[model samples]
Target: MASSRLYLSAKSAAALDAELMSSGGFSLDQLMELAGLSCAQAVYKSHPPESKRNVLIIAGPGNNGGDGLVAARHLKLFGYDPVVYYPKRPNKDIYNRLFTQLSNLKVSFTDDVNKAITETDQILDAIFGFSFQPPIRDPFVQVIRLLESTEKPVISVDIPSSWNVDSGPPKSGELGAAFMPDVLVSLTAPKPAAKFFKGRHFLGGRFVSKEIAKKWGFSLPDYPGVDQIVELPADNEKL
Candidate 1:
């Protein structure tokens, strides 16, 4: 993970997350890949694809759902047949475009989250983005409960579902009341909530950063010290 502290308050992070969706960073579909790839790297680190393990992705209705769909598509590209489960029908136009892309890739989508959970080796929680609205009920709550029961390792994109990224975790105070994701994949910068409230469970990495060449391990084309234009050897010297 590229380590550089780009600070932003939870509120700011949420705002940026929202703004980036609107800005042409690369359309909503591309932002989905940005968010999804961040989580996918964590999954790859934990469970390498060569092992042939199953990954279950829980998608919500909004852009969060788009992130999971993006991840599922990438996982398929990486040779992992991830099962994607979204409880509600996707309502966003971006999500619809993503659904079409996933269909083109032949990735499976289902509403049967229970079955998806039952069979996967790893679970990815992509249900909620940074924004949190209250009155957590039915399908989402039930899905959270099922995930709690499962012993599989879980990765969450942005914040886990049923938890407010701003105010903190859920307050139902049940046995597994508050949301806890094993790995929390953050984009661009770390959210304040993930730093202060989330404690040791938080793990963040950026999607893309401004740069070129070899400042760090990553190499970029035409980067300052790297791939600098130089004169070719003279014909006599070549001999």
Candidate 2:
């Protein structure tokens, strides 16, 4: 695996996505599919189906949520009983298609956020990505509060919800409950906020093109053998 010192800001990562598309090596659909698949793999590796098969995925209203929805489908195939709590569905047709896919896979959706946690052995925090801002609204806030209250571990996808793109979090330091997670699965590379993640950190999304990687000076470690995920060095060890 590559050394853990490399970090990419939100904007840069997005640019890499665009560049890859331009190169004709990847499309948004293909990228999302692989990204979500990688998340499922990480979840499986961290907590196998036999250990904690009940996964409660809290999907947001954007691409991050789509990733979660996709991950849910894969997790079910991987033998884990997966459920989703998607309170806000995007108006975009793409999300609608994803919703349909998950439904077709027989992955159930729950309306009661708090009750959902009680029914899960682990939580997948896919409510936000690198672009999410603070002052989270309504039912989501309540849901976050409930996750904090529970003792079960949460596996956050990409950047943790409500955190800034470049910085770890706000200086006011009020987002106590939702700021941390048990495991963080970063797609492509780690963002700045990932530096504060005090848990198992794994890097996914090894599908980046060499052309884009060179342009951005992004050095990626080869995926060890055929594995899709690689564990990152801890925060302190990053130096």
Candidate 3:
């Protein structure tokens, strides 16, 4: 059943990436782009752009942030007004290029989470990847705190900030004091948190080739036509 679908740990997910890319003939950029585009699709599918056109993208300093940057680009093109909150940016050129792309597209960046939340109808939480640890520090702590305090809907990318990959929520009061996503998008594979997500869930990483799926023993549901993403079955549904 979908409730009993497989989940990957941080270690296992990393290994799958190495195997998928090294042996399965895919590049990191390809996966990132696919994941980001899938996220944009989820944003539109979950909430109609006509009613919810304003989005606040909260990005971290890792690859997940890169995904947000890419997603913001597509969200803008998709007819949604996406503003970004990139507290800490990675020094990688690819990330800079993405930032540049946003600039070229005239997408604005905001540092104030509270203000951005007021302006946006929804949020994309890309502030952490699978490797994030609990007790989030500094600006991220402040940003996440604001997100939790507000009622704006959030769509967490990959893993929610400070959540443990294998153990679901980290060991803290009420799910690690993290921002609970209204919609959760799992890239590459669903982490253990998939079981905890009661909201709409999406499985991304369509870039995974057939060889990788067979070798890694992953059974993915049909994405349907040209859609970049598809809603995952609820726990009650059979896999």
State each model's C-alpha RMSD to the native: 10.9, 2.4, 2.0
TM-score of 2: 0.91
Displacement of residue 198 (Cα, Å) in model 3 is 1.2
The estimated TM-scores of all candidates read: 0.74, 0.91, 0.93
lDDT of 1 by residue, 77-191 (tens): 8778788887776566777777888889988877788888878888888887776576666788788888677777777776766666655565576523555666666555444
Name the best candidate (by TM-score). 3
lDDT of 3 by residue, 189-215 (tens): 788776766788888867776766656
Comparison by TM-score, 1 against 2, better one: 2
lDDT of 1 at 188: 53
In order, the Cα lDDT scores of the candidates are 0.63, 0.81, 0.81
Tens-digit lDDT track of model 2 for 37-147: 988988998999999999999999988998898899899999999999999987887788888888888999999888889889999989988878778897778876676
